[model samples]
Target: MTTKKYADFIYKQTKGVCNIMVEQMFSDYVLYKDGKRIGALYDNKLLLVSTENLNKLFPNAVQEKSFDWGYYKLIHIENTEDKELLEKAVRITYDDLYFQKDFVTDISYLFKVNKRYQDSITKIYNLHITFLRFCYDKGLLKINPLDKQDRILHMNFLNNDLTENGTKIFNELYDKWLVYTDKNDDKTDDRIVNTKMLEKYYLSIIDKLQINS
Candidate 1:
């Protein structure tokens, strides 16, 4: 709902930017002015310098309304997306704004929302990967659900841009995998012992997924 293109916004303001991600977080980042902090934005809210410092610099700065979105507290940060103004935010807030809640993402929700595109994943894969690879990469299949031929045919599902639902499903599965792996890890463990074992059974998982030339 935010017309804001966060990556483009930041890039326009700071040309030497790093990788851009939406719905993720970065720990306390600083703005350098001869190596000094002036202001900060956190969880996307702009906080100003100390009460006194903020008054001195941005005398007219005031609270703005959070944006309207169903089931989410998405706020529109005005004039503050750019660096010049944002620098002052860090010095003022003492840190970026941290929310008690995290961004919401559910893959099932996406599937339901885009029900019209029933096999959107298949379509995206078809448009991109060769049918063979598309069948191989661009899908969300169960780990136990795949046969060698199934894997070979579905690898192209990976090439699909992924409906919001697919992404959520992938993330949920991945998060569970990470937790399971980490919990299984004791000392100096890669944490995916269980998965690695599964890999032995599916070693040729990517064999069917020939990359497009």
Candidate 2:
């Protein structure tokens, strides 16, 4: 059984990261960052989502099944007293869960296609939906996936938080959208076909990421 004192100690060790939250589950505790679950204190042990970056950071950390029936496993962190490492581990796990590295690589490929030839609106819309779905599934974003207005609001929030590369990518995508719209003359049939193709591409990326995760 895990004590509140031990759970509090674990939470304290990982306190500096932004939006870190914890919830008690009977005797154990689950940890979250930016609304995504990153780790937990179970049976007095610290268990974090296993990822390539995390594995490299703590090569000797023991990996174990999260549950008897689940395929996903977690890394058992032994040294909870090292506050800096604990914080780093939580951040790494959260990031890996939030944005799988391979997803970035796959999206970059789409960005490389000629702007004049790409279906920019379809691509952008699908990308937005894909991002929202991923975040929603991971408990990072809260909104009905089917609600257009809510999606628009949250997507705006995401756009506001874009990194340098992210901003550049969005700009390129917007330019492509303008080109596609001008060329297509707002044809519904053409838009539908483009949306279908982009949907398949985005879904494949999600499938690959989930399989690896």
Candidate that scores best on TM-score: 2
Compared with the true structure, model 2 gives a TM-score of 0.49
Q: Write the per-residue lDDT of candidate 1 for residues 88-142, one digit (tens) a residue.
A: 4433333222211223233344346556875554333222222223212444332
lDDT of each: 0.36, 0.61
Residue pairs with backbone overlap in model 2: none
CA lDDT of 190 in candidate 2?
63
Off by over 4 Å in 2: 65-69, 100-213
Error of 2 at 205 (Å): 32
